[model samples]
Structures are given as structure tokens and as C-alpha cells.
Target: MPPSNRPIHARPQAMRNFRNEMRSATMSELTMPVAASPGRLDEAIAAFSRAIGPEHVHTDDATLAEFSDPYSPSSWDDYRPPVVLQPATVEEIQAIVRIANEYTVSLWTNSQGRNNAYGGSSPRMPGTVVVNLRRMNRVLEVNDELGYVVVEPGVSFNDLYAYVREHGHDVWIDVPDLGWGSVLGNTMDHGFGYTRYGDHAAAQCGMEVVLANGELLRTGLGALGAGDGWHVSKRGFGPSADGIFMQSNFGIVTKIGLWVMRRPDFYIYGFITVPQPDDIAALVEALRPLLLDGTIPNQPEVFNDFAALAEGAKKADVWPNPGRVPAEVLDGFRKKSGAGAWNLRFALYGREEIVDVNLAAVRSAIAHIPGSTVNGQKLRGDDREAIEALGQPGQVQAGVPSMSFLSVMDWVGAKKPGHVCLSSIAPLRGADVLKIRDIVRDACAEYGYDYGTGITLSPRHLTHISTLFYDAEDPVAVRSAYDFCREVIVKAREAGFAEYRAHIDFMDHVADQFDWNNHALLRFNETLKDALDPNGILAPGKSGIWPKRLRVK
Candidate 1:
């Protein structure tokens, strides 16, 4: 169960071989650009080495291979970029951006390269400069009293959590399914949290970003001082500039400030299942009272069958299935997860006595709904004993499933053709989630392909919803998967829903969701790219936000 034993580092043989080959190729061509001038490439590399030191300027086959291709389930030739550069400081990052702009070289920025499921960490264009931010990892400050922390983009949830606990701080990390992912990357992508502090984007107070033109801009309270940019307050005078950089390649975030939670005395984690699919509507109606009344303090995620089973990995010994507590798993799930109220994952946070009251209220509400039962276990002293168990992977009883689709997306290779996934988002609501899932499921069935979905409900904000899709790995399957993904996205727009994050390869296709005439924000990105990165240097084909390249008539 120790960290060293986790199979996380064990990549597939093919993936490893491809990485090694790519690394060697990168080194041989270190001084040469696929298209840029040799002098410019050398100057750029030299400037970068000067800024961060040559020790970190990796051109070796080992490091280069790791950066060349992304962990997407598709062919390497689909989204491979040539080189990678690791910058250690804000100044170094700014300098690199400046060079990229001047030389018209495309640069792709990545946090921990843990933006799994969507290929968010991959460069959309070939021969692009991947700006790896892992070395910038640091938890600059943790204000115990204010309940806020400032960190660089490379700070992973695991890293931040350890720092907080080791420092004797009375706070707990709001870990998503995967604990190794970057904190800033998740927030910037609008990732959901499972606890009370789940709406991490809302928890973020401020940021220090290095724009494509090498200018540093601080938003919110950090904007008050020219150089003092690490303030952890959520708002300030004038417009909030933080929203502009997120989900866009317009700027590079060097450092970020996020608000954490102060330890409360008692908390509860449990699930509620409703058996019938049609009854979900009624269940949602029942949930409104509890949500509005503050009885269910944490986010309650409702999962369809396939997702629930896909959540856990194939294993040996297992915990005995607890007897049905209150009701049966929901109906459609019988074919998939096969237990009783299609299932609802939920939790409670705050005073112990208050938690009990809320639990009672939740039971009462569910009891009113036909055939819905609520059964859950409240954590106690020894219940969470494994949480502090250190050394190995599963030692800690984090209550979250260890196997995640995000971690194995790249590993689940194509036996025949190829497999790619698409993650689409919608404003949170029971009906919208159900509708989207049904539409996509029907589409997959029609194509004679098996499709699955995973749901993550935003803890604080009920308006943000995320669904991940999985299918076979053949060219036809891959194309069909994308076709199905595209069809749903287009349908989502017509149905009044928009995605919060998209795969780097599909950004251009997904951009159609936003109407050009009304999408002023995207328009601003185009105008800014023209001004800051005039040659279309910083991630030219990224985010599908940039203009199309000119061609001969």
C-alpha cells in the first residue's frame, strides 16, 4: 500500500517504448525547430537555460519522450508535440513566453500533466513547446485563520495535503477522485470537489498569470500591488480578471491562491439510491427542500449504472456488500451496478448534532418518495483510521475509490482500432444530467458501441456538471466515438448546455457550441492573440479559439 508500490508509474510497454523513442528524437533535434529558425531556437533555449539553469533544461531522450506524446487513448501521431521546456520561476516562464512570441514558436502550457480523461495536458499542434510547470511546485502560504493557501500551478493535491498535515494545520484537502492531480489545474479546468469545499473555482481567491506577451497580471486583491501578487482574497474593485485566463490559452498561470476548509468537529459520508429511472425526477424534486433548507450540506451525486461499476477497478478480495439499508439501487442500474435507488453518493459536514438532524431530514424526504430508501454509515474515530496510514498507496482509507478512469485512460489501449474519450459539461440539474446521459447512451447504442459515463457533482455550486465517456479503440470506433461526442455537444448547445472543459484535440470542434456573434469573450481571445502573439506563437491551434491559418486560393 505504500507510495512506491502503486502501479501509477507502471505505464504500458508500448507507451514506454514510444516515449523512449520520442525522447531520443527530441534530443537529436534539440537545436532545430521543425519550422523555426535555428538561431531563434538556440537563442530561445539559451535564454531559458539562463533563466532556470541548464540542469532543468532537459533534452535527454528520457524526459523528451515523456513530453512528446500525451496519455490520450488515440494514436501517438494524432497529438504528439516535439519538445518540452520546464521553467522554475515566474520570471523564467515570462521570458520563455516572450521568446515564443518573438520567434513565432508554438508553446503549450501544462500543470502536472494530470489533466487526464480530456487530454487537456496535450499540445494540439505538432512540434510545439510544452511548458511543464511541475518544478514550480510550492505551497507558498497557508493562512490557518483565513483558511486560504497560495500555491504555484505545479502544486498537486497530494503535495498540498501533505504540507498542511505535516505543518500541524487543522484543515483537510478537498481531494477529487484522483489525489495526484494538480490543484491549480483542476480549479482552472473547473473540476468538482466531493466535500463542502467542492466548488474549488469559487474557493480560489486570486492568481498571478504570465500572459503570452511576458506581462504579469494579478487579478482580485493581488492587483492592488504591482509586484505584490499573492493576496488570497476573492474580490477587489473593478471587473474580476481571473475568469478570462481560465479554460483558455490566452495566458499562462505561474502561481495560484485557493481557499481551503478549516477543520470542523464532525462530518458524514454516505449514499442514497432510488430504484426506478423514471423516479429520478421525483427524487430531484424531493432534494430541492433539503438543498434549500441546508439539510444536505455536501454535494450529492446521482450516478447511472455503468458509471458506478466503472468507478472501481477489477480486484480480488472485496468488502462484503452491506445489506440494503433503506431502499434498493435504482432500476436501469440493475443491468449495470445491480443493487438497489439508482444510487446517490452524498455526505454531511458541520456540527455532530446538526449532522444527525440533517441525516434525519434526508431520511424523511426520501421516505416520502415512492420506493426510495436511504442507507448510509457515519464515520467515527477508527472508521477513518486508515486516512493517516502513510507509506503505500491503499494504506490511507481516503474513502475514495483508488481506481479512476482518469488515471488509466492512456493505459486502456486499443486492441484493434483506437479509442478516444470526450468529456462534456452541463449546468447542474437532475433533468439535464439524465437527458444528456440518455442521449449519449442512445447514440452509442445506435453505433453498436458500448458507452459509459461518470458523474462528478460540484459541491458548492449545483450548476456545474461533468460527464466522462468511454468506448472501444478502433479507427471506426474512434471516429464514431468522436462523432457521437460531437453530436451530443451540438445537441447540448441546442438544449441550453455548454461544456466547462474539453479535450485539447477537440477544442476547435467544441468551440462551435458558443455562438460567435454573442461570444464576445472568445472574440477578445482572438483579438488578444493577434496583439500579444502576433505570429500565432503560443499554442497556435490550441483551444480552437485562434483564427484559421491562411492558405493558397
Candidate 2:
């Protein structure tokens, strides 16, 4: 049978059936390392089952495998959690943590586990249990007047978008490339989107965290009244604690307050295509001033011809022959794309008059490029057909979310389709982008892989994220893909850059790149880890920042 035609939001029927079919793995079947004895592990499982109920405690290998990283290049056995737990309330989570500490067991936490890049849903250690929070989904509040929403970890981008639309709220939320991903999870990972609020972590106001010690704490204004008036004051009195929790294992964020934008009357999509690769520098310089002066408020993402033509594009467009398309054939795609060697995609949001004024200003900014092409289109946010016409990543820019980005996976993944992403932050210089692109492409070529790369822009910096696809069914291909990612990180670090995010296996590699002042950052993180989680049981090796007992290396 062909793949399910159900929309991306729907759960596959097979998955539903698989969830119901599970049996507990006995001591004989265990493969990974576990510090506790089999009898102790069984007792801990019983304790966890008592906390959240046996129905939610999944010890079966079939169900446990589902919680492992789907795109992991290494064997899933290395990262698979022994059991899965689903806790619906903070009290339940607190109880679960207490039980973990009692048995000295590790527990991994995930919101929706849909962020496929960087080891989706899987824990850093194999002996841990996956705490899946999909059942705790709830939209606690949507403040139309203040333009913010308070949501749980289970709330997906689609769920929030649907709620706002159904209620006819005149507001929009900045969403990342993938809509099915958890809103809180994406923000916590400091994920990027494509609007003014694209810097998701910066947009977060308050948080409710469940500490490793089974203590409930709130950050920012949330500390007051257990997060009362959280929306009103994103930053509370004294030092802000919100920054510490992101991408760290100090605590599990149960709820968050996210800023939303008031729907603009005129939403304009604009693009500038420069024919020559060298022109990318000139274009970057031209837009830098606009971005600084707020002429363009949104984060501008620039793509090479490969990214422009291949993303959400049909598989047959540039396949059959592999390893980077030839220049002549690439030029054909450029012609079809109306983009030269580089394409800059951005949006203008405001009233019709303000939008009209900005379009002229925008054209003037890019007027210096000789063969550059500038185009503009009005995005009617309320018009479904018009928004659909914009297509994929563009739809995301318009604050309309979709899983169209998945098309790339379908096109690239041969018999066994999977991708591992590595990203780094760089100065917003066209020359730098050109330099990094060469480094990334050459490294990928060395591994006989396609360098599917893209550059997402902020006001002063750009993030370079590349996807290395491999056949999951083939272990050698998977190993090659992992090696390619490691090589990419090494080259980037040698050039004085750092990975913004990394896969579970390479978290240590990315952290090692921060050697300034004898790796002071890691030391500081360790100090806090010891103070907050003295038991040293919360996500030990995450981001390579381990507590005292486990930081042997």
C-alpha cells in the first residue's frame, strides 16, 4: 500500500495500532547499560507506574522503540529509553521525578518530540525513560488584546493556529518550518522561524518548570503567584532565570507564555534574486542597513539556487543524477526560480499605505545589483487560496503553517530516508556566507553527499543549517552521514564558528568548540547543574554539560 494520504496532522493508522500492541521487556532482552540492578529497575518501573498509572508506563520494546530518534544515524539501541512515561499534570511529573531520584534512574523529557533534527524525542542516555507530554496539551489562554498565548508543552503550532482562526482572533504566531512540532519545545531549543518574532526564545515571556528535585518553580514574573501576570511582565525583577532553562536540563518547562503579533492589514512577500554568486555579499550589505533601521522588521532568509529549487519541489526536477547538480543544469533551475545565484526571501507587515512605502524602499535598497530581479506579492492572510498559492516556506512567513518542507525528505531519501542537521551561527556578511557555503559543499562532496544547505538571517547574524540525508536501512550509509556531519562541524569550528545546535551524538563535539578562557562556559553550566541537580540524574550528557559524577572526561 502507498503511504497514507492523511494530512500531516493526522496520526498514521499503523502507529495507532502499534501503540496498542506492547509487552514489557524482561531482564534478558535489555541491551544498553543500566546502572541499577534488574530487580531495582523493576521496582523503579513499578514506582513510576504508581505515579502516572500502569497504563501510561510503557516498558515494551515495540513502544520503547517508537520513542527513539527516528533519524538517528547510529543504532537506535544506543539512545533508546528503557520505558516510556506519560504524565498529564505537574503533580504527576513531580512524583515521577521523585521516583527517579529514589532509584537513581534517568528520565528524558520531550514535549511533542516532533523536532526531527537534533535527535527528536530520544534521550541522551539509553537507561532513561522518555516522558512524552503529548497528552498534557492545552491552550490555557489566548489574550487577543495583549497579543500573547499561554500554552502547555503539548500544544503544537497547528493547534494554536487553529484556535486563533476558529475564534477569529486578529493575531498571528511566528512558526518554524515544521508546523507539527511543539511550540514550547521549538522555542526551548531556540529554534528559528521566518518573521519578526522568528527568534523564538526571545519571544518567550514566562515559564513554569518542574525541577529535577520534584520542586515546582516559575521563571521571570512567573515566580510571583506561580506565574501570575506572566504575560504582562516577560522580564521580572532581578536577574532573569528564563535563559538558564533553555536547551538545558535544569528543569522541565510545563507551560510558557509566547508573544503573538497583531494581524497586519497588508502582508507583503518580497524577494531579490541576484544572478552572480559573488553578488551575495553586495546583497547582504544592502539589506543590513534596512534591517538595522527597521525598514524590514522580519528575519530575512537567503537561499542558494539549490535550496530555492529543491525545497518543496518535485523529486524529478533535479534528480536521477546525484552529488550536486551540474552548473548548467543548476542554471536551468535558476531560470525557473527567477533567482540568480542567490535568493533573499522576506516579508513586510503593516497597513496598506506603510507596505506600499516599504516596497519602494526595498527596491531602492537592492537597486545596485546589476542582474538582480526584485518581485513583490500581497499576501492576504485571511484568504486561504491566496496563502496556499504562496507555497511552503513562504506560507510559514505569512504565519500560515504547513509541513511542505517534508517534500525535501521525500525527494532526497533513497530507499531508507532520513536526515541529520548541523547548524552554526555566523556574522551576517555576504562574503562569510559564500565562504561557509564552499566549506559545507566541499565537505559534503568529500562524503559523496548532496549539500542541502540554507542560511536563515537575523538582524546582525545568520544561521547556516545543512541537512545530510542517508539510507536508514543501510548501516554503512548511516555511519557515513554521521561522519559527514562531524566533518562539517570540525571545519566550521576551525574557521572560528560554533554550532548553534547539534545532534545527540555530537553534542559533545559542538560544546568542545567553545574553548575560550579554558572552556569557562561549560564550567559555569556545571556549577549550576551541581547546585540545582545534586543527584546528577537530569539528562546527564545533554549539550555535553554533565553534572559532577558523570563529567569524568
Candidate 3:
């Protein structure tokens, strides 16, 4: 394939100069020999040429910049890879891994070449191979009978949706709103959707992974190859290796086996709106029974007032430009609550009877919250209206819809800003969730910055804290956001809550929260990294999960 068409828009001269300066400093650092550097990058390029032809490898500055930053409009930092290699086959991928191992260089795999906020398409570790997996994109196999699909790493949600629809299958593809993300990449990163198959992690049944040493391994029934490569029945024959590769830079996942959902007879998508900040604890208590009983089915995250309004208001080009509900519209909602702008979205499934039963239970629970009510659907409008509105600029909603202010990230403009998201995981218990939320909110206020937050509650009663959004253009605000994030993280740690997600900058700090003496998982990752990329090459500083050199911190 030819090189990617570079983005038409370029940053201002001053910003560009700064970027170039940063790149120069980075290059100088990379050039410093660590014991001994690998073979010349020219030789590495030549090796790539041999594997998939010379045209497939790219080393130019322009091309490198294109793959450097995730398209996150709120992020300012860019990670430039010394070289990029696009391979079309598993053999080629294995070959590249072999070459990287031989040269003691890093290799970063990105699917469909779009990684958005969490360093989309950018190498988590700078100077990594920056493997762009777009060329390998293919729906390798779709087993209707087995209710699973085998796809290459680069296969996207749009690809799967089209395939499934064209094949005339009743199966439903669990798609995030932005149909561009790779199926494998999203699942590996624990991305969530809004369907019965909401949890992408749960949708994954098996995977075809390229270990650090360039060996191929398959998990679950695929380990058995075990019958047709197209169908994988068992979850796992031994210890599950699929989970290990996810959120870890230990291996390059070239393919995956995902379980798709069958369309259900009943479906409901709407929000429960509330106004007061203090009512959150009561709301949490109300959600407990539904979540625990699995009546709610999938993940149901809570979005506070600011987050809810932002989601609906993002696409201001729509008919209801700033889709704000009238203050009176929410009357009788949670006991005459003023329109404070909070909405909790949820869905109920199964037979109509079961759904009705569940809805009744939901209403009963809502009754307990002082200022909450099951609201009419504001997000659901006529198709024509929705489609027409989508054509307007600044009205697009990318990826999955979340109540998180991060959903409104596109408003920031072309130059993506840099942000550090510090998320703490706490038990979904009402008291703890409220405590953390209050703590984070207060910290943000202390810094004279409004908090941009989102929350996700796990079925097992774990809550993921999200503190996102800050202006990278303003160094002061950026520093404030970073400091506030760190403060919240520190508070969470002191309160005995561990973090669930992190960026590379905060990985060391996150690890410090865990016990180094008896941390089995950390130790296990270390052993695995040694066994695989023994030279400590692949994604050297990603989340501190691997690379012995970075692990010293």
C-alpha cells in the first residue's frame, strides 16, 4: 500500500518548531548507546523491505508524524516512531518480531491505525517499530453456527457490521458509536459498548498472539486448532493467556475470536435524569440491587450533570443545537429537583415480561433517590433528523457514547492537547463511590478547575474513576490538571483503592500504590517479559508492565 495521506491541517509554526525541538532531543537520547544499540535503522528498514517489500516500510519524518499521535483533540504530546512497518500477514508479523528481537528494538502494534485518546496509533514507547496493522485487516472467518468471528487485528467494527449485515445473519455486532476502532484493539483495551455485549473484554473468547520471541500462540479452543481454526468453543483449556496480552505490551495480538450477540426481542435505551449533587449516594444505593442481580445486565455508568449535558450538546448542529432540557421538564424528577443536569443511562433486556419486571424494580429503586426520575428519551429522535444533523460540522460523536466530559473532546480543535487521566478503582459500594467522587471533585475545585469526570461500574461491583480533559495549550491549566489528578490518585491510594487505568507518565506512581513485596502479578509480568523480549525491547516504558530497564523504577 502507498503511504497514508498526511493530515491536511498543520500546527502553527511556533508549535511545529517546539515539536521539532522535542523530536531532536528525543533523537539525541535514542542515539545514546545503552550498552550497544541495535543494527542501524537502515538495516532494520531493509529487513522490513525483505519481509513485505520496501514500500511497506516508512522512516520519513512526515510519515512518522502521521502515526505519532492519537487523534485525541485534547492531547498535545506526539510519539514519533523511528520506523513504521505495515505487514499484511501473520508470517510477516512474526518476521518483524523476529527482526526486532534480533536488533533489540521495540515494536508497537496498532489496529486500523486509529488509537484516539490513549495514544491512538502512536507507539506507547517511543522509537518502537510502530507496527501499523491496517494492511493485515481482514475478517479471517465468521462462524455463524458457533456464534463467533475470527478477525485480524486490523479488522474494524465497521468491517464486522458490514460483513454480518451482508451475510444476512441475525447476529448483532456490538459497536461503539465511532465505528472506526479495531475490534481487537478495543477489546484488548477494555473498551465498553452499549449493547448486551457491552463489555468488549467479555466478548473476546480467544486470540492469536505473536509473543515477544516471534512465536505464535492461540488460546481457548483455538489452542486445539483443535478442530476448525474458524470455530473456538472452549473458553480455555489451561490458564488463560488471552487476558495477559490485553492492556499489557507483552505481545502483539494479530488476530482475535469474539462472541457476537443475537438480537433480542426487547431493547430500551434512555436515561434517568437527576439534578442535585448530593443525591448521588442515594442513586448508588438504588443501583445496587439491579446490578447485583444482573437485572441491569451490562455495565451502566453514571454521568453527573455536567457530563450528561455535554454529551447531548456536543453535536450542536443538530436540531436541538444545545440539547438542554428545560428546568421545568425535570419537575417531579427526584422530588422537585432543579435542573442540575445529570442523567443515568440504562437498558433492560430479556422477554417483555422479564423486562417489565425489571423496569418496575428500577422504578421502585428510583423512588428511593430524592431527586431522580426515569425520563423520556432525549437521545432518541427520528432517523432522518439524526442523520441530517450528523452532516453538520462539530456535531459528530466519535467512538462510544459516554456521560464522561471526555465525550466532548472534539470541541478542542485540531491540535490535540496532552492530558493525563488518573483513574482509581474502588468497590462499587455506594459509600466508597461517593467518597471518591467527592474527593476528586473537591481536588479539582481546589485547583480552580472544573472537574471533567466519568464513572464506570463493573458487574462485580468495581467502579472505574475517570478524570479527563485539560487544556494542554495553557501550561498552567495543564499543570493544575496533572497535579490535581496526581492528588486524587494519591488520595485514592491512601484510602486503599487501587488504580484501574493509567497513562505512561503515571504508571510508576500507580505501581507505587501496590505492594512491591508480594505483588504476584508484577513479578509474573517481569518473568514473562524476560522469557519473551529478553533484551527489553518491545514498548519499553508502557504502563511499567514490562521492559526490565523501565521496571527498575
Candidate 4:
């Protein structure tokens, strides 16, 4: 049999000491960029202050700690920046870039700094200055006819949703699990949502980027001055430079034009449950044809009983025993909660008749699964109160955003709970889903942790999201989670799979796995980095694309 799984309990005294050490370290020192001289760094700070006001240039420990990665597996000292500059406009960002280049100081850019799982506002390399675009919040254009919205980096999902609702627009904004993150930032990171416009990157049309050399460039039709089709036309002339900027250090995106969905007359929100653990294979197999036929309009999420449980209750409350919970215990909880071993949730949008037809198709497809059930309610698109009442899961699929999903972080019941996510893409096949699931679940079990994960199925592909939650205050637990994540990445890659995105700690590792022809892709990325940011000043280590100066020859 397997080794007995032991519980990793949080030690209060150790945690207190750790917090004290972090506080003292942050309070006493300011870490300057690796190669930046004191005099040049001071000059850059002064220039930044002058360009964006003294109040926006922050060097205090409190502010720095606030921007550090709360979920980082390593110490905050590994990722914390010495200074943070908040720019309010595109011109201000350009000025900051120029100042950074002149001073030989690297910059890490973030919008609202709420991407907690992937590193929040923390820079990939410590000692780099952070360029926060929170102050540049603005919704520049909302074209109802064209079904698109042009927004700055600072505009959050909540902000955009409120704007559309306040103005009584007939369009809806597709948001991720959390509503507080910047829309442009999330889109740039290739984040996904639940609706038909779930593919955030694909929905993007135009971009306004501030290059490393302090030059401003508008992509797509935005290249044309006063072009009416800037937000509508995705491809303008020849080369599409918008993709090069995403998840790269090539440029800091100041503005973006994203396509939104017009409100349908009605929408049908539904859930399907399968009793057996391995029944997910059959469920995916059944849904594949419907998804391929365009019968289901939105991405469907399949969650194990443990994942569904973690969303509402803490692990200690349900299964106090350490390591992975016994299968019988999980089955008991599932029975008590009237949930299945595998639960699938999805939504269909259109007119009443159209949704009805699709709903019937979905039911007929999944009917073959033994001991399976399907249920849901159809709501009017115009009924705001009804939609909001549907809660986070339902509201998100209907184009409303909520922070309720953040509760999963607290499932470990720690005062300072945190998690790192490992999301890998697989073909939309039942066997592929099962393969990825077994790999991740077995790894979690071996690491003395419960398998807390789910799969988000798109039409052609599926995203396997495995969240490793731990007590951020416990160094041992943090390190264990980090190691577990790295091991999972290696295992997935060996099985011919790779992550869509990764946390700051694993960015390099993940990028290294995409080594086709002796890392030809990374070589090309380096070439671009050297050309665009010759000084290697803008986000040096983002997505494992480092500048020539930083790379070991």
C-alpha cells in the first residue's frame, strides 16, 4: 500500500515568527534593481515622481508588501519590488518607460494587481520597479451597435459591468471567477470566462501599447488616425503585433478593445451530475458531440465532489484526517449534499425557442450515462434582479461577475490561505480529460494533499485547472506546495501536455518544456526582446523570456 499520509498542521508560534521576520526585512531595506546604481535609481524615482506626482511614487514598506505576491511559494523577498509607480495616462506610462530605460532599471507592469494565483502584482524578478496602471482606469468607448468596449488597463470587470449596466446597454461582459481584476490585464494574460465569448484573448480586437523605448503604437485598425473600425477590425494591414505583447515583456498595454456579447432574449442555466468517479469519462464523451455541433453555447465546467465541497466549506470541517481524504468519506459527503462524484455546470443563451431546442439536445446527449441527472432554470436576460440572485456560478455564466469563488482559497481554513494554480490544456476528449485528471490527482495524493481541481471544457479543448492551496504563513507547507506543482508540471509535460499559463515561480520551467528543435521558440522570443527592449528594462523575466543581458551565455 501507499505510505500513510500525515497531516501538515499549522504551528502558530512558527507563523508568528515568520511574519515578524518578513515585517522587519521589508521595513529595513529597499531592494534596488540588480544592475542599477544608487544614484541612477534615485534619479529614476525622482523622474517618476515628477511625471506622475510624488503621491503616486511609492517606496514605503507597507505599500511594497501590499504589492508583493501573497501566494508565492517562496519568500516575498524573492519577488517584491523596491518601488511602485502608478501612472494615470498613456503619456505617463511612456514617461515611466523612458525613465526606466535611461536609468537601466527594469519594470514589471500590472493593472489592478489582483491576479493572485499567478503572482498578483509581483515582478518575476525581484529588485525590479513595478509600473501599476491602476490610476489609468477609464472606459473610453462603448459601442452598442458593434458589440465592443474600449478600455484602459485600469478598468476592472466590476467597473466595466457597472458601466454597461449603469448606461443601460444591451450588451454583457464575460468575466472570470473574480470580478475585481483588470479587464485588459486578464485579456492580455489570455484568461477565460464561462460565456460564449469565454475566449478572452480571441475576443480582443485592438491594443494601445507603450513599447520599451517609450514609443506608442496602436495595433490593428487603431493604426489609422481617427479610424472608425479600430475596435471592430481585428486585423488591419499585414502583421498582427497584438499577440507579441500578450504575456510578454515586449510592451506595456495601455488600452484594449474587447468584444462583448449582446444580451440574448433569454438564457438557460443547467447542471448535470454523474454518480461514479470515473463517470466523468462518459460525461465528457456525451457532451463532446453537442459541443462540436454548437448545441451548447458556453464552456462547461466539470468538478469533482471535493472541488464542489471546497467552494463552500473548509477541509477540516469535512475531513479532519490529513493527507488525501478517504474515498468513502468523499462519497459520504457527496451523498449528504445530494451531489454526485462528478458534477457538470453550463449555460445556453438565445431566444426561448432556441434555448429550449438546445436544452433538449443537451439532455438527450447525456441521457446515456447511468445514474445521471440534469436540472436547471431558464431566466429572462432583462431580469437583472433574477440574474443576480442566481449567485456566483450562475451569474458569471450570464455575464455577471462575483468574488464568491475566492472562497476556495480559504478552504484550508488558514488565516493566511493561498494557492498556486497549474492549468494545462488538453484535447476535448474523455480519455484526455481522464489522463490529465489521474496524473494531477495521483500527484496530489502522493504529496499528502487532497485532489482539489476541475476541468473547463471548451468546444475543441479543455483546460485542466489544479489548485494547490496551502497556509501562506507556513514555510514548510508553502515549499511542499511549490515542489508538488513543479513535479506536476514535469509529469504533465512527459505525458505530452503543457500549461497554458503558470505562476511566476514555474514560468521558466513551463517555458523550458516547450522545447521544440532545441528551444527555437525561446530563441525567437529572445530576439524580439533584444530588438524591442535593447536595454532589457521592461519585465525582464516575464513568461521566461529574459533579455540577452540577463541570460547566461
Question: Evaluated with lDDT, which candidate comes out highest?
Answer: 4
Candidate 1, residue 256: the lDDT equals: 77
TM-score for candidate 3, please give it: 0.80
Decide which is better by TM-score, 1 or 3: 3
Which prediction has the highest TM-score against the true structure? 4
Q: What is the overall TM-score of model 1 with all chains considered together?
A: 0.79
lDDT of 1: 0.60
Error of 1 at 146 (Å): 0.8
- 10 residues in a row with least lDDT, candidate 3: 1-10
User: Against the true structure, what is each candidate's TM-score?
Assistant: 0.79, 0.90, 0.80, 0.93
Candidate 2, 1-553: lDDT as tens digits: 0011111111122222432332243323422234234665789899988888899999887787678877753354766777889999999999988987888777778899865868888877656678888888999998878888899999999998898888888888888888998899899888878878889898999889999999998887777776358876777889999889998889888999988888787788888888897787788888888888888988877777777666766445666665666678777877775667888888988888888889899999899889988888986656666876888756888778888777777666455477888798878887787777788878867767666667787778888888777666566666667667777788888886678888776676577677677778877888898898887777766777666654432
Candidate order (lDDT): 4, 2, 3, 1
Kindly list the per-residue Cα lDDT of model 1 for residues 320-416, writing each as its tens digit: 2421111133233364554443567677667778778888888888887666778755554233354343211222123232334343333232242
Query: Please, what is the whole-model Cα lDDT of each candidate in the order they appear?
Result: 0.60, 0.77, 0.61, 0.83
Task: State the lDDT at 541 in candidate 2.
Answer: 69
Better of 2 and 3 by TM-score: 2
Better structure of 2 and 4 per lDDT = 4
